[model samples]
Target: MQKDKRYDQLLDRIENDRDELVELCLKLGNTPSYHAKERNVGDLVVEWFKASGIAASLQFITDESVNAVATVPGSGDGTSLILNAHMDTGPEPGPDATEADKKIDTAWTEGELIFGRGVINDKAQLCAFMIAARAIKRAGIRLRGDLTITAVAFETGAPSIDKDQGVNYPGEGFGTKWVVDRGVTADYALVGETSGFGIVRAECGAVWLKVRVKGREVYTPRLERGSSIQENPNAFAKAAHAILALEEWAVQYQKKEKLEFEGGAIVPKAQIMNVRGNDEISQASPFCDIYMDIRLVPGRKPEAVKKDVERVVRGLGFDYEISAFQYSRGHIAQNAGPLIAAIEEAHRYVFETEPPLPPSAEVSMWRDLNVFNEVGIPSICYGPPRQRDPYSGAGNRAMKISDLVAATKVYALTALLVCGVSDR
Candidate 1:
């Protein structure tokens, strides 16, 4: 049979297992592991890996639950070819007012949209890659390169609190000391993050910050002589003044530094993202916290950014507490890696059109691309653009089986292009 035919077969297999896949994603969504309790989903991934004839185990890399090396190795170089995705969902899984009132109700469709909470955020990608692994095994694939993969916990939780202050933050859930001892780096990584347009060559690294604004509190009705206007305003208005100051400073920071992005452009003239005041944890209290998201292009120092932002706060006459703390950075492989060429050529043969600009466009959104990048390995983002309309051909909600079929063909053909036309 032709290689393209086999690729179609793999995608079909995924379709065959669609119900199981959806069930798995739903289970993960319902786990309540969000960040603090992650053992449930981590164990589930291990079972799936073991079933695939891969040796798998779970461990605590950071304080959060994570996977040990899950591998399928034949006679080949140890440089693993990784298919990456995460196991964590966004916030706690519950219906908010916006989601409760959508008209289409695709999620209500049996075997259709399946929306509860994490239907789109990331569980879809995780399920896709897991199903892709099964399809590969079922399609009888043996590679010249090893394959290693992981879906870690706590990838979504954030906003650390000292805890000593008895101040717990939302989302991150009281700051667990999660550490990642990346066992081994892979030669190439496919993030499995809906890489439809082709390959995402570069990702902008991000740093989150907590910016605080402080003011004295006084009783209401003491309008003229009391500590604050807006009847104490939660004493938050003056803090708003400091917030404006930070924004102005960020604008100025744009003037001095810039990163040279791919496609003959510069990335992130200053920091890419900022979360301060009500934008951060503990909004109503006297202190306003903000998160600054810094998208770094490979070489910028995240520490320097911390100092600069702190300086900005001081210049604005705001007494601020700054901590560089934790961050999930960005990464890029050579504009074109070995498998990348094969992947591109495969898409060209199948699609019969030149791919869009950079092949895969990795967004500023965080993913395992940063994990491999931190460990000195080559990785890029690849897959379909399923996030665009939210409702594509298949169910008019998530990726159709047809979308998976197209992606599977691209994956197999890319394999053939790199491994050669041999029945391995």
Candidate 2:
């Protein structure tokens, strides 16, 4: 593919500011922004935007959460683009978490990689978008269409369930939905997420279901133990049986509902997230509630999955009730040709090869890209790889510096290509 002279210029500018990019990423990553608490990181993001001469502001979401919206205005005749990344990191460590768990949120550099909890999941991409826009401004490139960079809060998969404190926790896509509903839209959107330098146009939507199993409450002395868990009077025992049955069903569900698309594949999965029963050990609980998260491909209704789950658990011969508390349908980008072409060109220029397909895990997981596609703005996710820890065989809380620079270059060129240049 023939490269544009302007594209070369943009890449050169990004390369020149590599140190600044790393510094910004480290600062953002080192700050804690666990869901519902993004004010500190939001402040840092806004500060960087203003320092780099980009128009930026914070859209307050809650008392402690805020979304940072920065923009480069265009001359009004070309397609606009929105570059998005979440402000929240993964769930915070529990009170009894190990030292390693506690250190996951603190960013650090080791050789070529930057490590932190949200670095690979989002902050790396967030900093990349910021640096990319800064490079565009420094290079004095005026776009014909607007370019918006958004770092939204509460994009993690945590849901709000009312307990003693009420629904204080706002769920995923909360800030993105708020910003978009209030006129932060564009003709196209590119979500910055971890995709191993691949492009993704589809993601799995999620359904949060609560399943309750009822049983006769009894004190331990008067409790009647049965040979089978189904016959046991304790709801906890029956709940255990239901959990096992659902685990078996989940294996088959993933196989049956796997969706293969041109951009990538979506594997709908099911997992039991939480289970609640009696607080007292001496008394048998009257009911046990199971919280489950079931992922679905585009066009799969929550009602249908509810029925499927009912069929499996009902077979265990127990009285149970199931309810879907939240449902968000997965989406594939429509009218995304121009955005896709721009990404392909930019990726080729940055990596010197055709962009690869996103990992199945990244493609199958939900992101703010689904929110944009849900709202009729054609959108896709493209970013660098998440490094894995060789010793632990778990996802390393880190990202490669080289990968971050490459993603930054792609983002800048993609914005320029999609938004076009003003002949000023």
Candidate 3:
């Protein structure tokens, strides 16, 4: 079918409301929701949804986190559509912030880009969904299927390890899993993650592993030098060997394992993020800890990855205890589905060009879409245009203002098409 008048009308509406969309994006980006702490941002979403004439509610995931949910009912004869994104920005700079890092909390427009924490991480998606819902309402289009928007919490960082904070070692997909388990589900879910508007159907799974290497404590003088090293088992020395071995393993793994897709392939990766041993200067440390982050392509299980780590460590003849500290599975959705088709159609209509092929896996990262996919909901990530910060140390997170407008059009159009308009 050729492009329809409804698609053009929606695109025009999104373009005309560009200023409001930018304002909403700034509002969401400026509101800081650190980790499990998202009360203010969550409340803001709820308030906005209700004010826009959508049904809104807050579902508590924990004392510290809540999932803000909004819905527009359809005719009940078609598939329900879910527009999802996390409310939490990535790991906070903690309570202590240098003036520069603190500036990241404020959203500002510089030229054609909007700089802020959540703009690309997901505040942009949150606001885009809100605007899309509002456009559907403004156009007076009644969908045959229900339209639901879930602005979830903690999608940016790993699960809480702090028990006193009421979080007990949660990992990725924390909020989406909570909502799914709590009976908030849909036939199709469009995850608003930063993918430069690329449709993402697959992603790599990941796990955090902690390895402890044990050795006999010995005096410094007894530590062997050169060829004598065979007789001495210094924990620090053993850790050094283990770190090098792990690094080499990571290089080989990346070279050997790859999952190819339309645009690119995902390579499984392993890296030693941290290493620690006793601080005593006079003696060889008896134990050392190694922190490992392993990324696996979809179809590879975390258990298997754990086994691979154990195999490498055991091969080195080191007495060790390895544990999967935390883990999240990856997902692969159908290459073609109603949600994908609707999004592709929206992209073509909005950009007047063919959409890029869907990404193989969101490279190395995971999203709430993984959670929804696990629970049998067909989900994919499609959001505003963004690029990774070249300086990971200095905060320069940003996205194009034009990209936001285009994405809002795609999102609004996707919801309208997937939900199916009804005469009622």
Q: List per-prediction Cα lDDT, in the order shown.
A: 0.55, 0.87, 0.79
lDDT of 1 by residue, 297-385 (tens): 55667888888878777765545576654565565556346867766776776577755644222453455666665566666666655
Query: How well is each residue in 1-424 modelled by candidate 2, as lDDT tens digits?
Result: 5877877888888888889888887888888998778899999999988988898999987777889999999999988999999989866777987777766767778899888777776888999999899889888999999999999998884776636233235566877888898899999999999888888999989898999999989877877888877778888888989999999999999999999999888898999999987676767679999999999999999999999999988999999999988787789889999999999998888778999988898888788988999989999999988886432226666778988899999999999899999998
> lDDT ranking from best to worst?
2, 3, 1
lDDT tens string, model 3, 1-424? 3778876787788889989888888887888787888778889999988888899999986676889999999989988989998888866786777676777666778778888776777788888889989899888888999999999887765643323234624677788888888888889999987776678877778888988888878776765544433334776677777788888888988777787876457767778877777767666688888988888788887787778778888878778888876788887875338888898888887887867754443555778888888888999888765644443354448888888888888898888878899987
Best of the candidates, lDDT: 2
Better of 1 and 3 by lDDT: 3
Candidate 2 Cα RMSD (Å): 1.6
Go through the candidates in order and give the C-alpha RMSD of each one to the true structure.
6.1, 1.6, 2.8
The C-alpha local distance difference test score for the whole of candidate 2 amounts to: 0.87
Q: 118, model 3: CA deviation in Å?
A: 2.2
Deviation of model 1 at 236, angstroms: 1.8
1 or 3, which is superior by TM-score? 3
Winner on lDDT between 2 and 3 is: 2
For each candidate, what TM-score against the reference? 0.72, 0.96, 0.90
